[model samples]
Each structure stands twice: as structure tokens, then as C-alpha cells.
Target: MSMQTPKQLGGISFGLMDPETYRDMSATKVITADTYDDDGYPIDMGLMDPRLGVIDPGLECKTCGQHSGSCNGHFGHIELAAPVIHVGFTKLIRRLLRSTCRECGRLALTEYEREEFRERLQRAKDLGEDPNDVLKSAVRQARKASNCPHCGEQQADIKHEKPTTYYEVQDVLSGEYSEQIAAAMQPDEDDPDDEGTSPSELASQSGIPLDRINEIVAGEFRPRTEDRKALESALDIDLTEEDMNKLMASDIRDWFEDIPDDDLGVLGIDGEISRPEWMVMTVLPVPPVTAVRRSPSITAA
Candidate 1:
């Protein structure tokens, strides 16, 4: 009972078994005027409610509260045809709608309509408009404008954002920060590394450095996000799972291990390891452990 699909546009709405109707109608798809949205949902036909110039089918009337109306002002005319049953087959009936006119809203129905209107709609449909055009026009009407129709604020400045779905969020985020995001999605604090040790294994096997690990993990002394990006670019590393594991296992001090203080140029921190060789550290993730409990015996009272 969606209020806005082509079924609505074709002046065909309410409830019907679509699969059964498709079989009965000998139709393969429930196509409307426009077949897709930006993300590819079939546009609803209610977009360009067509009208038949004859007896008001009452189905297309704008009178919302009377005669079991859907209250949509679309679908001016509908052509109702008999359920075409072939031979010895019985099937459920579902209504299918197609827009006969893109303007002055009209439709062909299989349920309620007089023959005169059907003939008129047939002539009009034969004379011109395609269902696809009507659907596309409707989608255009439903599209969001740059400014809020009510308040007139621009989309960028608006506070009430149209909540984005996971799909849209991914589309937008991937398009904008594909590189940075790629860098960020390294092996989550799990999985093994080159040395055959997971972050948790490294933590347990080398516990003495836990404090330093915490410092980096908690963002206390590690390089700022910007600095990390700069280093990533300098190393020409992807900062992916392998790269992250390598970085996490090795201390920053190891970067300048045997290079003399005079050769601090190797790090290019303006000839000085600004972070100090001693304080530079490696981080290992801690493992999560679950408490195992023995089942208690229930003694008879």
C-alpha cells in the first residue's frame, strides 16, 4: 500500500497480490514511467497522476476523506479490463497500472472504469505519451531542491539533515576520502602479523612495554593524525594490514637505531628526533579474555 509508486500513478493502488497479478496480466515487469532513482529504485507513477476527461472515476478525485479515497490527486482516468484467464488455469488477481497520459492524469485499469473512458484513454495513449515519460517527470517533481522549501536555507547550512543510509554514507565517504579511509581500515586489533603474533599475543608475550603501548593507543604521545599522514606519505606505504602490523611491532626508536646523532637527517625531523629516541615506543593491542565458570550442582533440598 505504498502511496507513491507507478501503481499509484497508473491510478492503481490499495492492495493486490503482485505476483499473482503479473501472471494473470501476462506481464513480465511492473514497469512505470521512470524505471529508476539515483540509487535505482523504480520511481512511483503517482508522480504524474494522469487524468481521463470523462466521468470522474472517483478513484482520481482529490477528495481525501470520502468514498475510500487514497487522497492523492493523481490518476485522472483508469481503464478497467476483465481478468484474462487462459483455459483451465486459476490464479490470484493483482492489479497492474500503466499511465496512459503524462499530463491531465489518466490510467488504464482492470478493476473500475466505464468502456467509454477506456476507449478515450486508448485513443489518447495511442496518440502520444509513454508511461516512462510520466514516471520520469514525477521523479523530477519529488527530487530534493537545494534550498528548503519551508525555511529557504541552503542544503549546506541546514541543521535538519536528511538522515543518510549506510549505502549513501559509503557512497559519499568513499568518493571523498577514499585514500584516508583506505589507510584507516587496517587489520582491526585482531589477526596475526608477520612474526606469527597477534596484537594480543604480542601484548602477553611482552608485557613490560604495556604502559608505552597504552600511551600510543590512548593518543597520549603518538604523532598527531596530520603527522601520521605525513609519515605515511614519506614512507610511500599503504598503511594497510601488513603495513600497520609492521609499524605496531617496531618502536619509533628503531627507525634511527644505529644511525648516529649526527645522521639524524635520516628521519629529517630538522636534524633532530623531536620525539626523543628513548620515549619513542611500539604499541601492542591487549587480548580480550572470557571468564570460564564451572557448572554448579543443584542439590535436592
Candidate 2:
């Protein structure tokens, strides 16, 4: 056979793989954490499923039908019970969340500003120059808008707690209520009839689970007027129109999905190879056993 060598090397681009692409390339789905069976054979649908590739010398690869030494191996995938944020991309995700409208998923900028940014990004790309500075400027401007220019919905400040947790600062008690609540919460030893609200009660009300908040936001759960009144009376404070809510991986993914392809360039993303939603992982790829296992000689050493 004759071989041809290339004179010039083209550039390489890296991108995240979406779930569809992951499943398409996978040889099997790994369900169990267990690797082998009681009889010392690889288990089907398990982490060490033979379909993922052969690590043992005598065994043939189920996917490629080749012996261990000759088989290059294949990939397997695991479907996560819930979507999870990729730790590496948490900062980028936070930037995207702050710069885009939560409801309309468009850049939180005026029409003129959006057009201006798109042009700058496209010009930079055409010159083969880095567009990071332009992207940062757009994010900075978008973050300043209190309401979405496209949808007119109020935008809340998104705060990231260490690692992966994100919280939306929806609303706060007004100055008047803050002062009243502070006074009401104080205990007066001289007046035995005075009862101060416990801290635990306040914590419970404020720390509503993200899932329940999602339901409430979707109009799936509605509190009766009486219940609302009762809660206000018990707390000795009026609840704000919107309560602070946590953002889950799924919620973040949904927000990203609403972003249009045309806007991705301004967000420092290439829409052709990567979508923003893919940053939150729904499926994980597992390398073949041969690629991970240590040889007997290396293990002994």
C-alpha cells in the first residue's frame, strides 16, 4: 500500500458533545456500577460490559469481534438520573445566565446594541482574531439591564455559590418591612406575652426547594389566597411578589436552549459544533476498559 503525507496542517477545534452525539458513538449503555459477574465474566449492561471492549487477552471484543491486543476498544455511556453542571464550565454558565434573558433567552440588550455586538464579533472572526474581549464587553453590558429588552420581564441578579450552586435574587423585603420585622423579632423580657418568631421558621420559608419553586413558576402549583394570608400573618411580614429561587442544572439547560443560534457568536460560542445546553451534562461517556486498566506487570511494580 502507498501512503500520502500532508504538506500543511489544518487547525483543530474542540467542542462539547451533545447527548445525541454521545449515544450515537456509544457501543452500549452502562446501567450497573458492578463490573464483573460472580463467575468472573464481564456482565452485560454493566460498567465492564464486553461490548465496551475486551481487556483480557483471550476474550474477543463484543463490539469489534477482535482480540484484546488488536482491538482499539469502544465507548459506553451512562444516563444520569438528573442533569448535572460540568464543574469546568460553571463560570461560563454563570456568565451566560447573567447576560441572557431568563424568559426570552435573548441577549439582555437593546436592538441597536445587539446588532453592534454581532457585527463586532463577526468582524473579529473574519480577521481570525480572538473575540474574547468583545464577548466580555457584551456580557458586561447585558448584565447591567434590569429588564429584558426583548421580553420586558424583570431580570434578577444571579449569584453563584461555590462549586455548582446558583441562586436568583428575585426580591427583598422593602425598608419599611425590614425595620418592622427587626423590631417584631426582638424578645422583650418585661412583656411575658411577647412571642418572637423562631429562626427555624424563617429558614424553612426562605429555603424552599428548587423543584417546588420550578413548579410554582410553571403555574403547576398555586397557593390559595387564604394560605398566603395565613403565611404572612404567621411570619409577621408580607412576602415579596417574587421569592428567591435556586437554579438547578435542568433549569439552566432550559434557559440555554432558548438562546438563538445567531446570538451564540456574541456569547463566545460556535453554534455550528456546540450548543449552550450541552454544557449541562445529561449523559456521561465511559472509556473502554482496555484504556483504563493497568497491566499486571505495572500493578505488581
Local error of candidate 2 at 198, Å?
32
Candidate 1 lDDT tens digits, 1-301: 5586554355643322232232343212223334235532223332221221111233232223322123322122112232222211111000000111112112221122223333444454688854344333322332333332333432211111222100111011112233443343345456565233233443354342545434433445443445444434533443322111112112223432433332221112122323222222222111110112111111111
Off by over 4 Å in 2: 1-9, 126-129, 174-243, 295-301
Best by lDDT: 2
lDDT of 2 at 249: 94
What TM-score does candidate 1 reach? 0.14
Q: TM-scores of all models?
A: 0.14, 0.74
Model 2 TM-score, all chains together: 0.74
Worst 10 residues of 2 by lDDT: 173-182
For model 1, the stretches where C-alpha displacement exceeds 4 angstroms are: 1-128, 140-301
